[model samples]
Target: MVLLYDWSDKHKEGVTLMNSPVHASDLPDNQFDIGIVGAGMVGSALACGLARANYRVVVFDRQRPPPFDPQSQPGIRVSALSLASQKMLADYGAWQYIEAMRRCPYRRLAVWEKSAPRLPLPKLGGHRGTLFNCKDIHTPELGSIVENNLTHLALHKAMESLPGITSMCPANLEDLNFSPDTATLTLTQHPPVTMKLVIGADGALSQVRKWANIDFSSDQYEQQAMVITVEYAGKQQDITWQEFTPTGPLAFLPLPDVAGKHYASLVWYNTADNIDRLMKLGESQLIGQIWQHYPDCLPAVTGIVDRGRFPLIKRHAQTYFSKRAVLVGDAAHTINPLAGQGVNLGFQDVMALVAILSRDGKPLADPGEAVHLRRYESERRPLNGQMMLAMDLFYHAFSNNHTPLKLLRYLGLNLADKLPFAKQQVLQYATGIKSPPRWLFR
Candidate 1:
């Protein structure tokens, strides 16, 4: 299903359909119900859901990721996708492609304190670590570690033949105009497009958000994440671990085995200064540093495959919608990566928004109406806020040298490990199946 559209003429305002043409005569030739300003995972997911529900949708992005290969070495950038998110992708028809391409499923997730050496667990007769295993809940696995590009590639593939989905790649968002009932997008590569709703899934610095005059609260996190891919010698393991340090949490997320060797992705969260110094070192030297600082539970790294780094920040749109427009994913909120919940949160937003818009089994009437969009905001805002705050609390509690905080966290972890119900609740939150206890918030 290689559907094609031509942008061969730079001056042309209309795209020429090449292969099997769409039934454009049924609807207005140029107008769309929704126009999404970014084709990243969130934007693409929303497009899939809406188009599958029979809503006209257009997704715009500067570029598309290359097709992923199951045999290729995994990238340093990866996400810990939750179980709830997996079902969403399955519904969107992307999960099958993703499964065929590559993914690493982990049955257990472990979190521990890096400074626990000072207070030996045996001496205190307490737990050595806190762990959540999928088997406890009768689930096959907690989730999967998927390469960022592979997920994007899967979404793009799923969207290729979906009815009412328009691909606007290699196109630039020139400007946006909003009337009382409509929004018009001006793109550099194509003509003007008028839509009832202009969805801003364009990420944190969303131009559509600014154009809609949506205010946002953004704070710079003190830590930067250093990500690296490693090739190791061993069987493919099925456990993900995060060890908290005064700087930040150092995590090891496994990758599927290729050939006879195994692989894993590492994320070292630390202050900007430390990350800068670490990045300046040679690969061998940096690997040596990682081996020294990271927990011994990590698999032996035979070679460093790749490395990258990015600064962390917390961002939340003051509101999710404005005149004839709405924001989703990183455009609405970006949380700390300590729990690897960023993408899952975005997928959750899409699911909520789709549920609100598609309840009628047809394209929404007056799609940009405040009444309709506000429902989405009301449903998602609190949950996203709770997760954001929860991550912040975890960050401060674990990423410090304070004795009292350390001891408190240790005792809490030991207790949590000993209590079956408490551990299940935490897993539910982490896996996006349920929210934290209501008592915590009250």
Candidate 2:
């Protein structure tokens, strides 16, 4: 289904493929019990969750779905979904569609020292250290790599089958008013509506958040990230590799074959100035630079399909909930993408908010009491806080080229590799199983 969005005017031009007109009369006075801003993965998932709980729901977004053309422009960004996260999407009835769309599962993951040669396995009588694989966890695959667009599409499709869901695309809030007991939004394109709760699932630059007067603290990272899609001519094994480098951590995330060609998503991290210089480089020149950095074990350069760069910033709102309004996903926090935990963090937020608002066979209406919102905030803030701190420490330690830090990194990786128990523990943490502060679910 093609859902072309025409944003010619700030108001009155938004419509979906079904050609259903959205206007003030479409909404009943005090009709929908909940309103969600933002239609990204988190927002869409939350909308489905609430609808399943039997709450009247509406979703507001600026972008509309493009046709599902194979030759369509590929999305510039992607996300890594953990094992538990994949299950959550399945429960929401999107796994089948997402699996058929753009998911690439990795059966094994391999991490090695970047600058140095592959270390020889330690000898056990006549044999060396054993190689570890995903089978250690009793599963054949570690996780799946999904394009941002595909995930959204699958969720959006599932949402269509659900009752009590009304999607408003290419719409923005022209006016908003909130109080301790009730919240109201006046969409410029449609009639005004009031609800018991308003959720900010919009994104980092959330309009809902701005209208609610929620302040956020942000930190700017000196580094920038470049995303590239490359063709590797080597074996098409199901494995993902991460190599810590002087500039930053380099990751190769696998993709399913396209007519027998092997493809991977690359994340190249470096200083902002250096990234700017490369952004201006021609396609051939950019490929040459990548070859210079990753010479060995890299497949022949089939092509660099798409490349883009962006400055890295970490943001967290001062509070997750205020009055009758609440924030979730990038609306609440933004973290480093190095560990591929950004989406995972958002999934946890959805879980916590849904648990508080919909569980125990309670009313699907207004879960907006101060005490209830406080419970949501308390569960997510510390968890996200700890993740931000961990990412900062790893970024500083591995990206720095200081003499002392070099020795410390080498010692750390070597020790972790030697100790079987430590290695397994680290694996569990990376796989989102066990951690200092575990996720709200599992």
Candidate 3:
């Protein structure tokens, strides 16, 4: 037995939703055109986009992001948002809030392999490594390094400002059921709500994917990543760099200045046991280790703010849709964070799905129609697969001490450095400026 509410057609204007739980019985109607689970960066952005397209949207999450505080230390988690993703955020009206808060813009990206002691060659210089300048591609900057929570907060603001969005936070989905035309969501704190389409933007551990009976395959990598937030003894940097060693890559992403102090995030990839050992070290000891192993490009570390670690895993769903439900973002696929393209790929998923749904200048009469769902899956699956494969290749090729592969990598880096046209093309692809077949947009 299920309960249904008489949904209203009139849109509510100037409604600002809070993070508190809302009982289904208290609403004008419990039904919505779309119900989204997981109000993270991707989920919140999807809710805002769908609402802007005139679809009534309800978003559910177990918790809400804490309010942003400028006085607080920088978070260890951040994402390098590419140009294409930036445009999408701007289109959804969230970029304004992000800019108003804080963001670090980087104009150059550098990649190089550190020489092994066993090798016959001397260490490489900055000139020997491949550097990508935004000037070469005629862009002011390659991307912006933003805190994940800040992006989520901005999108939440954007969603609250919209007329057709209902945000249900501090709420969890107890159960989900599907019918021929709609899906029913059972909440732990609120009554059951039904919608034409249910989006599983929850994340890698998506319960929606499980309830929909969708199966996915995943593979864990040999190396795990440890991220550290630190203050550097210098001004804010405009360039980000990564140095590949036999263990893994050590990377740096700049963060905005806090109270005139320069801040940055560092990623150290190594075996799980090694990362655990490193995590056990005192802040001073860890900073000493970083200075000993990291490249010469790293500035002096003033202090350590925070640190954390996560295993690298590759996951992809067998299919992106089942019955009345569809998947997006980490719910559908998760690739390597080597190039920092994970969030950008999720934003691309949002763009493709929203475009497919509103192709006829308006959303389809049935947002959950099988044809529309299949089209969305078709557009995203192969592209995501390609990116995953590329990352795996990069991981394997650079994580070994093989002599021939080392020579090849050395040659490849120098070759990429010398070829202006090739560098530009790679830059465009990396920055998410490259588009799918134009027909997909039409």
Candidate 4:
């Protein structure tokens, strides 16, 4: 029988339960209630949530996050966390750690199309772009920009503090087998563990999904993205902006000040070969290239700290669950990063799954029951699919040079800029303050 504790009222109090040693004679025949693969942001966050509800959770990851250093330069991998995501972290007690470490919050967001040859159309004075302000939506700030490593570390710390969670790091899943009532996971460095439910929080190339025999479809985008961490010659700014070109988008995201110096993360989207050429350039050469090609509004870049590149791909599993196994986060779906909703969608998955398993603060007797897993899939799959479609639309529309589509783009941005209701709705949706209605999913 699964062990359950009523943690609803005492969740704020830190709890501790030592994990059983690999060869401990007292170890239960079935040690864990839930087995989670991948302990990154999504997986760790899920572990924290379930543990808070007093579920015996075991998490497996191949590697551990490096210890954070206050003096180190920001990592090239960063994410813009929407308000909804922040709330989820705060609820799990991880946001406090993130705030104590480092984060940069932006109150405004701007997007515009770069100037190019235009067909005869009404020209708007100044830049034809939509600027979204937090005040417009009655929110204090839009979202916070955080280093991916810091977020992972914060969630990892929170997971460690929860008594109900057992973390197995440097442990690789050697094999997975599902019986009638439970799933067994064989790890390279640890004894096999059994659980009533197994979840795949692994990334796009999910081993759990593969082991479960779940099929997914993926499409590679024509453009690749290169991210550069740099210091700017000014104070920290409260805004993030993106300029769209026929090739791809040029985006600037503010990072927290380091040693009283302002820093920002820049993203340049282009063809794979072009990104490779940019990546090969020296620091000074790349800085010069930024000044030559980027929009005039970009601040003077003083020095480059680090840079990396990734190919864009959209993937979705054909189904979220197979038998006793289920998928979440990137294991379920991945969208174009044009809108920065990838992780927020993952957090949403965590919330929905947790809510289903721990209904009304009462842990289910069998968390892996097919009916409960189906409900979790039913709640998240459509929303993820919808967001994927929306990102695809933006990716295609902004990356095209068609004259007619260009005019439409200009008009859409202009209308979004001028219309109060439309702008507010768009802002709320983008910031994750609002979600699409159920009727739209019909």
TM-score of each: 0.92, 0.88, 0.92, 0.93
What does the lDDT read for residue 13 in candidate 3?
38
Q: Write the per-residue lDDT of candidate 3 for residues 11-124, one digit (tens) a residue.
A: 133334333333446464778899999989999989878887888888887766767899888888899999999999999999999999899999999998888334465445
Count clashing residue pairs per candidate: 0, 0, 0, 0
**Per-residue C-alpha lDDT of model 2 across residues 1-442, encoded as one tens digit per residue:** 1122333243334533332343545444444678888989999889888888777777777775553555443466778888767877898888888877667898777655565423343332321222346776667778888888888888888887887777777665787788667788887645676778889998999887788899999999988898888776878757777778888877788876666777788888899888888888888998899888863656676778788897789999999988788999999999988888998889889877887888663455457677888999998898898888889988998876776676666666666656778777666666666654355323
Off-target runs (Cα >4 Å) in candidate 4 are 1-30, 120-126
RMSD of 2: 4.4
After superposition, candidate 1 runs with Cα above 4 Å error: 1-28, 117-126, 437-442
lDDT per residue as tens, model 1, 1-442: 2222323342153554322223334323568898889889999999999998788887777666765655688887889999999989999999998998889999999887766645544343454668899987779999999988989989988998687887766567789999998999986645688999999999989999999999999888888899989887666789999888787889999997776679999899998899889888887898799889988877778888898898889999999999889999999999988888899999999988888888666777777888989999988888888889989898888877887787789887777788898888878877877866666654
**Of candidates 4 and 3, the better by TM-score:** 4
Q: Tell how far residue 353 is off in model 4, in angstroms.
A: 0.5
lDDT of each: 0.84, 0.76, 0.87, 0.87
**Model 4, C-alpha of 58: deviation from truth (Å):** 0.5
Under the 3 Å rule for N, CA and C atoms, how many clashes does model 1 have?
A: 0
